[model samples]
Target: MTQDWNNIPTSHQIPHTRFLVDYFIKLPTQVTAFFLTHWHYDHYRGLGPNFQQGLIYCSPITARLLERITLVDPQWIVAKHNNEPFLVEHVQVTFLDANHCPGSVMILFQTPEGSNYLHTGDMRYTPDLKEEWKILNNICLDAVYLDTTYCHRRYRFPCQEKTIQRIVDIIQNSIGRDSHSNEIHCTSRHTLYLIATYGIGKERIMDALIQKGYRIYASPDKWKVLQCLEYWDSCLLNDSFTTEPCASPIWLVGWNRVAENVPGRLLPNFEALEDMLYMANYYRNKVNSSQHGLLQRVVACIPTGWTWQGNNREYLQEKDHSRLSVYGIPYSEHSNYEELYHFIAWLRPKQVIPTVSFSSSKRQPKHPFDHLLAGTQVKRAFLQKWLNNNPKESCEDDDKQSTQQLHNQPKIARKGDILSYFKASPFNS
Candidate 1:
């Protein structure tokens, strides 16, 4: 299983098999191994005391990170380099670097019966990646477990570089205006830049901030993780606004804080309640005197892909008041519709299973192969071939018939002639 940390099984419902990748659900079964895709909390949080039966497998970088987080027993972590193939219970598994986050990987599984499967664990697909990962394009896979987060037609996100540059532009523009407006009191007043980040996904954004020479104020917990991850840049500091009001420009906050309607409101883990209230009140009073007063107080920048859902644009503009402002930028780790299509077109798997459950069957479009397909794309060419191969039954019916045929076959073969067996089933070896 991949990305199933949130689905912890209760005592009533327990899984039998124990091979998992990045999912930490508790079960009664004996664990074979824990294959982690990355070091994200949602993916790696299953490493609790209740489930410690198997060896933990992850990339080297992710292993180093897990050591600092204090989630699971670090003694069990075994770092596997990318592209190295390992054997586990007669299945040959290989890992390839997934360009989603640091240490994220695409796991490929090969069985002894000459069947191959690929699981893309939260990745952003590109033409260059397709070209470089030759195994993905060269072989025909038996099945593909795909990341369908943005598999709908409406999702078209800009490249990561462009989005990062735009965010930097917004911060720098605010700083430039602050320097001009508060020149006389610049030494006394400071701008509070609230960067909404999940612990690991936005490291690239942090690198960008460091490149731009912005000092990021990190909490003790986040600071420890960052230090263990070896992000020993000069820009990361430990100074709160209450301690030095004019000290830092950027304060690394949480994702929940960015979704808040009011800026400078006291968030639980981001900062002190009194400090935030003082900053809010101080900026509200200073708005009349300084042109960049709103910028000086607080600006909430949320890096997420949900910017395209519904009326987010209107909400962002409406929330832009005197003290606090909210902006959502398109910075996603998942592949979009076009990328998913390209992956399907290239690999041409026999079956495509979505990692997430479908929302509403009524909301989805219906086609001839609606029940068989995974995403919105109606693979017409594949459908035509499938229909030609099985003319009497639909894909679902064909699956049922095949399964029934297997069950009905004799378990023990009588002394049958090899020639007769070969002639009876030409496809069989």
Candidate 2:
């Protein structure tokens, strides 16, 4: 069931919300099963309370990330790949791709009564796909729970390819060889400090940095997440550049808590006006000039810019933009507005669900479960599992199967139904 959105602030006064999964939602009936589409604190488990037992389907990456990033117990996690089906006796749970992060999955719950339901956790567009996004556009559905994270157009974002390269080029030119030379040395010896963000989503940025030969360092908490990457061997194995001892790492903390204690040491960047001022005048000036005592290296890459939202605008970009060879690489783990909208529109769910609000100016009653389930491969897995489980009932299952291949499900809305099904159920309300 739904709860008041305002309680979110007081709910978890921490830098990020301790109400990780946000508030709990209860169905009028017994909560037989649960699902975690992705491991973002906002969507998955939280400080809310105990999880109702059953099957909590998610992706392998989500499992690793959950164990590493959240308090979600390993026993509770059922890591399923895109379209992999894990049954809870009567409820058939299929883990599909949400495309939110490395291991996000959407949920497809088929009731024993033959009611088919879809929950698109949080999804986005990725260039590499076998079927132009699962090829599931034609499935007719009773209804679908959606990811309205970016339902309105205002929250749209750019494609990762364009965005990633732009950020990399800026970093390469700034941190790598500039017009002068191709050396990776900083102009100033000042620590190339950064305010780390999107522990899961932004891992790629750090990986990219390490790939380009920059020393990789993260806070101990962040390292918890880093340690869980199964494919990380390709990037970190014997690769001396991927890590630096951060026994006492500086924090890239939230801008709101600039004055608060940062455990070891917190360095504020462009999270706020004052932080930007300090960086612009103090840190930015260092990167601008190449003189710093016997240490000719000036401390560059001190974050003149902050997180993605900080760089999403002109003032933040221009004012807090990197001045020194230390570049301000604007990047994010979340799919941008365009990808969010296109993915949602393409999925065309019968119903859209509201998710955690992005910001103050950008709140919506509808959540984004659709975008979270875009590239999920769990359909195939579910089918296989179902077929194996109910061999005798193959004819019955086939009878219900729609002519539409899962990928080609048309998402057009039936008139007037939006208002009826669009609202959260009374029990949730």
Predicted structure 2, TM vs. truth: 0.59
Question: Residue-wise lDDT of candidate 2 within 1-429, one digit each (tens)?
Answer: 534433333211111111122223432233334556676666654422254444455678777776656656677776776665656655666666665666776566666676555655565555454263463556544444545443433333445555556545544553432355322444333233344355565555555565665555454565567567665656546442323332111223332423222211224333343443354345434545543222222122222112223236521232233331233333434444445445545554444444523333322233333322333224544666787873333433432342223224333232212212134422131
Task: List the candidates' TM-scores in order.
Answer: 0.69, 0.59
Per-candidate clash tally? 1, 59
Error of 1 at 353 (Å): 1.1
* Top TM-score model: 1
Worst 10 residues of 1 by lDDT: 418-427
Quality of model 1 by C-alpha lDDT? 0.57
TM-score, cand. 1: 0.69
Candidate 1 positional error at 258, Å = 2.4
Superpose all Cα atoms of candidate 1 onto the true structure and report the RMSD in Å to 1 decimal: 12.9
User: Pairs clashing in candidate 1?
Assistant: 24-46
